[model samples]
Target: MEEQFYLVWPPVLLLLLSLGRRRRTLVLGLSTVVVAASAASWLSYRTPSGGSTPDVYFSPVLGVVPLATGCVLALLLDDERCRSFASGLAGHLGTWAGAAAVVGVQFWIGDDWTDHAWTFGLLMPATGLAAAVLIGGLVSVRTPVSVALSWSPVAWFGRRVSYSAYLWHPLVIALLGTFAIGWFGNVWLFAAAVIVSIGAAYAIEVPVEKLRARVREARRLVAEDHAARSAAAS
Candidate 1:
């Protein structure tokens, strides 16, 4: 069956825009959007192209619920007095709890990601919570893990090869499958794809980053000079 992602995106966008508005209005708007999203997802699932499963039908609803709720929580609970508590809750307990929930749910559902167990159930909310925690932690950390991870072999090479490999790996996979190379097993197929992706990133992407960095630095320097000149004139 052909996949179309627009089914999931529109309602999420509406919910995001409704954040920070009046509670009554926001709640009404979000409720409407959620129902619409759920219905659309379900209809898409029931359509002849796809099989009927509650998970597939309700995937978009699952993702938007946490986002809408969090926005509401942030708006309604915007309290200076609770800052410390919110920080602590977000950092230590929230991040790990959400991650564990995802791992647990995956195990329970037998690791079926596409059929909707991963998309609609615990995975989406867990992802949102994990993102919130990671962002919070990164903001607070004196020396961020990004710095460490950036230099790690996995990250460095992964970032470098991610682009060309991402673009070309699909074609490579299609070719391999067409040629009956998949007889080796799915693991080998995946491994071969990864190796190809990394090779492409290493060979094509690292050099492009150098040019991109230089351009960015030049722009920064120009902006700094303009600021200095304005200060001098003032």
Candidate 2:
């Protein structure tokens, strides 16, 4: 059934495109049909049948295709009032709904959510689109300073060596556990990993970034000098 739909979708989409008067409705309806078909393919999947393997195409198909389709429809409308209304409506629903679902699921699952890496990967692009729209709407009137203030903590943590901590902390905890340490509970292990991560960040990663920046600047200066000498000769 999935294979049949997958094969047929292209022809159906082309048929929809041929309909001039109902293009927007047909495009949107076809997009929804595709989303539902794709989602059904996901939900009914069986691990034994190679369904559990991570699908990298999920986000591009589910998130990006719909967005592109909507934008195409807006452009086809070509009227300011219609475009504005459509954009606003679509932006509100997509951004708010996607962000809310991701946040809600994260809260519900907590640390365990990372175990289902494939599911999270599928949702992330949609979540990103939502975040982009939400941030765009908020920043339209605000200063960059205000936007930076709003985003600083999240930005800092995302750029930090938190991933290094996440990657290595399990090994550290396992080693500690091997020693039969009763005191190394989740809280203690987590705190210890954080301390080690911070130390590593300051001692190693910061220095590496500084060295890379220095090298880049040195190359830029050398290039500038060469350019200046060539210009002088000319």
Candidate 3:
């Protein structure tokens, strides 16, 4: 959750900088430079006795590099050639293989690898690129993989609850911990967290969205009525 707080400012800054024409190029170049600088800074000060201080993965300031890199990759995907390349790569390797490769590399490296500067500086961007390619590839083409992802039940539910899930999952996990419910295993905990988060999100967000829609509808009717009166007078 602290990571989520740290993540907020970088994307906002990227969004602000992304305005206007030539945005893709501008953002890509800017993000590249920022990522390079972050890596360089890590390399300069990193010691053999690795520790978490000045970590790029979690540092409020340095964390921007990964977010910015994501922005850059997303922007690149907007280009037809880049999207085609991604789609082709996924198509050639097969979707499952591509996905497995990405997951396997991350698992192989392990989480603590980031404690060392060399691995963090090198693998972070590399893994980000791999993930972007797989995701971009999946959505860009009309394969079984893409079709499954676009299936209404899966897509709509995810769109509606994903943010809520992200916000509420930590609380649900903490509550479970407090109750000492996690002694069973992580699988049960994860299942419980997901169920609770989705339920909570729908309970809150659905009503709020309905209210917002009603407000907009009211505003629209008022404007229409005012326009009709002006036209009558004229």
Candidate 4:
């Protein structure tokens, strides 16, 4: 939960990258440095009390690593060398292996091993890159999983509720915990969170979005009217 504020780092980095989009080499070099610094910080830094590494975990550097990796991967999509690397049987095997390694690392580390730098630094970014590649590849190929995800209802629900769910679910879980609702298992908790979040999001966001759309339309119409008047006057 403390890490929520640090989530801003990804978008901030993305904005910087967007600003420097024309300078691809410079952006790549900076991204590489940031990633390396993040990993190095994990490897070198330790808490004074030798407990969990919350400082490193919640640091802005670590927060940007995954999204930064994704951005780098996106940039590489146009590269002939990268395309060749991702096209063949070897590439397919590498993608699956990377995915498996991600899962295996999580299983090996278990839920209690939060202080490990190797997990945060090396494994996390690797897994994030692997996931981006795997998912991108799947969607590009239009696999059955991607097709189901693209279904109108599913896509609409995701577009509408995903951000709201991400924000609200933690609060919902915290509230449920505070209420001493011990009967709810993980699945029940997840179900409750989704239902409640979706309803709340629809109630809140739908009206706001409609208002925004109306505002944009009004502005457009006013601008067009002014332009027409100027043209007629001229």
Candidate 5:
């Protein structure tokens, strides 16, 4: 739970992102190193019976591959031929397979989590890869998956407050814990948390945005007044 374990990724990701468009080679090369180092670390990691390596446990190593993978994808997607190939026959089925794999992989992890070396080692990257594919499929113009995800209400709420929902869900669950939510169930607790988080996100978002707009308007007015005075004095 020590948050410092999460700190290494952001700076590296930012460094990759900060390079100008011309720094493709440097960014790609460094990203590849990150992915490799992360995998190596994961593979070589030795956890005690009850102890945890926060870095691997938090899956920062697993995250590196995806960050690098995304960069590779952005490069590939930029090519028209790659785009055409992605929309081709195999592409369609691959996305669907990826989505199914995401669901199936969870069961796999639950099946014999502790004993499986490969599964435990590769879990983060494999799962992240499947998830990236599912997200890719959902946004793809050629797939019905896109249509399903784009349903008005789902998309609207997701766009509006998904971040808020993520931020507030755990807090809501902790708050509700004192009530002994077993009366209804954990599912009820989760649902309540989501609702609270979304509402909180929306409430904060709308007011903060309005305030920002007002501040921008006030600045514009001040600039206009200064310009007008300068013209008159001239």
Candidate 6:
């Protein structure tokens, strides 16, 4: 079941590629139908072998409905005609509305969030919708609170180290537990994990990216030099 998670990429790639080849309207329609259908029938899906975990890869039905929502959002946002429209949409989402949205999501979750199966079940699509709106607001030409959020040093630093942080977070949590320190819920534990994750990002991610850029530059120079030599010889 763990291995099945990797299976998602191939289908997602195929779906995205298919959408890329289609007209904007067609892609929107297709994505809408997919997300709607997946959400509508999400409740009926059962886990394999009576396990607690729901099988994300539901064979004919894709696991990530919210992923479809993201695809639609991407399609809309990437189009030149959509640029103004997206900006307008973002400008309309004021600070008050953003606060209200957060409250609504929290209220929907309630106290016993984990125990509530539907909350967990519907979370992905809900999160996708919320993220789409927030992202749209941030990237919009005219903004209010989103502008502040974008400029905030905390957000800037998190964005820089986020990928490596993601990679290390689970391992950090596990190590803390093994060492009898603390679990994920502890603030101190999270702080330590974040520090370690940031260090990892600085040590690994930055270096790898720099090396990749240098390799690309080297390849380009080699190609140009070869062309020059050929031209000179001729």
* Worst 10-residue lDDT window, candidate 3: 47-56
> For this target, which candidate reaches the highest lDDT against the unseen true structure?
4
What is candidate 3's lDDT per residue for 1-234, written digit by digit as tens? 346746775675568666754766666676776677567746654543454444445554455555666667667777777667766655535455556667788569854674577565666656665666566657666677668768998897678867877888788767775554444766777777778878877799888999999999999999999999999999
Estimate the overall C-alpha local distance difference test score of candidate 5.
0.66
Q: Give me the runs in candidate 1 sitting further than 4 Å from their true place.
A: 1-39, 47-83, 105-173, 177-184, 217-234
Greater lDDT among 2 and 5 belongs to 5
Give the number of the best model, judged by TM-score. 4
Report, for all candidates in order, the number of backbone clashes.
Answer: 1, 0, 0, 0, 0, 0
TM-score of each: 0.48, 0.45, 0.68, 0.72, 0.67, 0.70
* Candidate 5 residue runs with Cα over 4 Å from true position: 1-31, 44-55, 111-120, 173-184, 217-234
What lDDT tens digits, residue by residue, belong to model 4 across residues 1-234? Answer: 336535764676568668865547745675786578566757755643554445776665676677566666666665766667666654556556655666676667764456566667776777777677675554334345557668999898789988889889988878774554454566678788899879988899999999999999999999999999999999
Query: What digit string (tens of lDDT, one per residue) describes model 5 on residues 1-234?
Result: 225425764575467657654345745685565458556756756544653333455454554566665655565566667667776664676678887898888666652454444543567667766776666555444577667667898888788878788788768867786675464776788678878877787689878989999999999999999999999999
List where candidate 6 sits over 4 angstroms from the true fold. 1-25, 33-41, 44-63, 94-111, 177-185
Tell me the lDDT of model 6 at 3.
48
Order of the predicted models by lDDT, top scorer first: 4, 3, 5, 6, 1, 2
Cα-based lDDT for every prediction: 0.55, 0.55, 0.67, 0.69, 0.66, 0.63
Q: What is the C-alpha RMSD of each candidate to the true structure, in Å?
A: 7.5, 9.9, 5.2, 5.0, 5.1, 5.1
What TM-score does candidate 4 get on C-alpha atoms? Answer: 0.72
Residue 37 of model 1, lDDT score: 51
Candidate 2 segments exceeding 4 Å error: 1-96, 110-151, 162-184
Q: Residues 178-207, candidate 6, lDDT per residue (tens digit)? A: 554434456777787889988998888889
Ranking by TM-score: 4, 6, 3, 5, 1, 2
Model 5 poorest 10 in a row by lDDT: 111-120
